[model samples]
Target chain A: AQSVTQPDIHITVSEGASLELRCNYSYGATPYLFWYVQSPGQGLQLLLKYFSGDTLVQGIKGFEAEFKRSQSSFNLRKPSVHWSDAAEYFCAVALYGGATNKLIFGTGTLLAVQP
Target chain B: EPEVTQTPSHQVTQMGQEVILRCVPISNHLYFYWYRQILGQKVEFLVSFYNNEISEKSEIFDDQFSVERPDGSNFTLKIRSTKLEDSAMYFCASRAKNIQYFGAGTRLSVL
Candidate 1:
C-alpha cells in the first residue's frame, strides 16, 4: 500500500516571506507525485507534479516543488507568499502504471499568511 | 486548458433520502473518478470508472453508493440513502494519462 504524510498540520507565514511545505511518501517504487491547493469553499487545484525526469517541477501560481528520491520527499516552495496563497495544501502519490489511477493523499497542511 | 465540470455546486438532502451528484469529464479523457473530502479531512477516493465499468473502488463506496456513465458526457454518483456523515464535498475527476483534472465539486449536506 502507498501512503503520504505531511508533517505540519498548520503553518503561519508573514506575507512576502518565503514558504515551504514538507511532504513525504512511502511507496514500493517510484510513484507519480503531485501537489494540490484548495481554497476555502473551492475545489482542489493542481500546483505541481513529478513523474520522471526533472527533480524540480514548476507549477501554476509561481509555486514549485522538488522531488528528492533519496529522502522520499517532495517539498513545495515559493520565494514569496501572498495573502491569496493562504489555503490547504495536499501532497499525493499514485502508482505509475497501475490500472487504477487512484491517488493517496496526505492529511494536508493549512497555510495562513499574515499581513 | 481542458477542465472537468461538476453540477450542483451545493446540495442539501435529508437523511434516508437519495441524492445524485453529477459530473462531466474532459471531452477526450478516458478514465473517470469520484472522490470526497469531509470537512477538515483529507480527500478520499470513492470510485473509478473506465470503459463503462468500475475498475476500482474504496471501502467507503458501499452498497449505498453507486456510479454511472449513463450518457456520452455525464457521470453520476447516486447515494441510495444519505447519512449525516455523508455531508462533504464530492469531487469529480478525469485522467488522460497520469495527471487527473478535477472539477469544482458538489458540496452535499445531509441534514
Candidate 2:
C-alpha cells in the first residue's frame, strides 16, 4: 500500500526565515503528489501538486514544492516565512488512473512562526 | 472560486446514537469524498462516491457507516451507532478534475 511520511512532528521558525517541510512517500510507481495546509479550525487547502510535468510546482500563499523521484520526496519550501504561515502542513499522494483517487496523507507537520 | 460546504460545524452525539453529517459539493464536481482526522492523527480517507454510488471506501467505513446522495446536491454520511472512538473532524471534499476542494469540516464528538 502507498503511504506518506512527514518525519517532523513540529517545526518552529523565526519570521522572515526560510522554511522547508520534508515529505517522503513509499509507492510501487510514481504517484501524484500534493501539499496541503490547514489553519486552526479550518479545512485543508491545497498548496501545490505534482502530476507529471516539472519537478517544481508553485502554489498559493508563496508556497512551492519539488518532486524528486529518486528520493520519493516532494518537499515544500518557502523563501520567507510569515506569521500567517503558521499551520499544520500535510503531504498527500494518490495513484494514477483510478476511478476514485483517494488521497493518502502523512501525519502532518505543525509549523510555528516566531516573531 | 467554488468550494465544498458542510453543515452543523460541530455535532455532539451520545454513544450508540445515530448521527448524520451532510455536505453539498461543488455543483460541477463529479467526485465526492469523505475524510476524517482524529485529534492528532493524519487525515484518513473514509469513502468516495461517484455516479450516485460508492466507488471506493477504506476499512474504517464498516457496517456502522453508510453514504448516500439523496439528491443531486446533497451528499451525506450516516453512522448507525456512534462510538466514542468516532469523535473526529470529518471533512467533505469534491473534485472537479484532479484537485479536490475541502469544506470547513464538521467536528463530531461522541460522548
Candidate 3:
C-alpha cells in the first residue's frame, strides 16, 4: 500500500518569507506525487504533480516541489510567501502505472501567513 | 476552462433518511470519482466509476453507498441510510488522463 506523511500540522510564515512543507511517502515502486491546496470553503486544487520528469517540478501560484527518491520526499517550496497563500496543503501519492487512479493523501499541513 | 461541478453545496438530512449528491464531471473526461473529507481528516476515496460501472471502491463505500451515472452528464451518489458519520464534504472528480479535476464539493450534514 501507498501512504503519505506530512510532518508539520501547522506552519506560520510571514509575508515575503520562504516556505517549505515537508512530505514523505512510502511506496514500493516509483510513485506519482502531487500537491493540492484547499482554501477555506473551497475544494482541493491541484498545485502540481510529478509523473516521471525532472526532480524539480513547477506548479501554479509560483509553487514548486522537488522529488528526491533517495529520501522518499517531495517537499513543496515557495520563495516568497503571500497572505493569500495561507491554506491547507496535502501531499498525495498514486501507484505508478496502476489501473486505478486512487490516491493516498497525507493528513495535510495548515499554512498561515502573517503580515 | 472545463471543470467538475457538484450540486446542493450544502445538504441537511436526518439520520436514517436517504440523500443523493449529484455531480457533473467535465464533458470529455471518461473516469469519475467520489471522495469525502470528514472534519479534521484527510480526503478519503469513496468510489470510482468508469464505463457506467464501478471500477474501484474503498471499504468506506459499503452497502449503504451507491454511485450512478444516470445520464450523460450527471453522476450521482445515493446513500441508502445516512448516519452522523456520513456527514462530511463530498467531492466529485473527473479525469481525462493523469490529472483529476475536483468539484467544489457538497457538504452533507446529518442530524
lDDT at position A57, candidate 1? 96
- Candidate 3 chain A lDDT trough over 10 residues, lowest sum: A94-103
DockQ of 3: 0.72
Fold similarity of candidate 1's chain A to the true chain A, as a TM-score = 0.97
Query: In model 3, which regions exceed 4 Å deviation?
Result: A96-99
Per-residue accuracy of model 1 over B1-111 as CA lDDT, tens digit each: 778889999999999999999999999988999999998898999999899999999999999999999999999999999999999999999997688989999999999
* Predicted candidate 3 versus true structure: per-residue lDDT over A39-75, tens digit per residue: 9988889999999879999999999999999999999
TM-score of the first chain alone, every candidate = 0.97, 0.98, 0.97
Docking class of 1: medium
Residue B65 lDDT in candidate 2: 99
True contacts kept of each: 0.74, 0.90, 0.59
Residue pairs whose backbone atoms clash in candidate 1: none
lDDT of 1 by residue, A15-108 (tens): 9999999999998898999999999877789899999998999999999999999999999999999999999999999985655889899999
Candidate 2 residues B1-111, lDDT tens each? 777899989999999999999999999999999999999999999999988889999999999999999998999999999999999999999996698889999999999
For candidate 3, list the clashing residue pairs, or say none: none
Error of 3 at A47 (Å): 0.7
After TM-score superposition, the amount by which residue A109's alpha carbon in candidate 3 deviates from its true location, in angstroms, is 0.7
- Sort by TM-score, top down from the best: 2, 3, 1
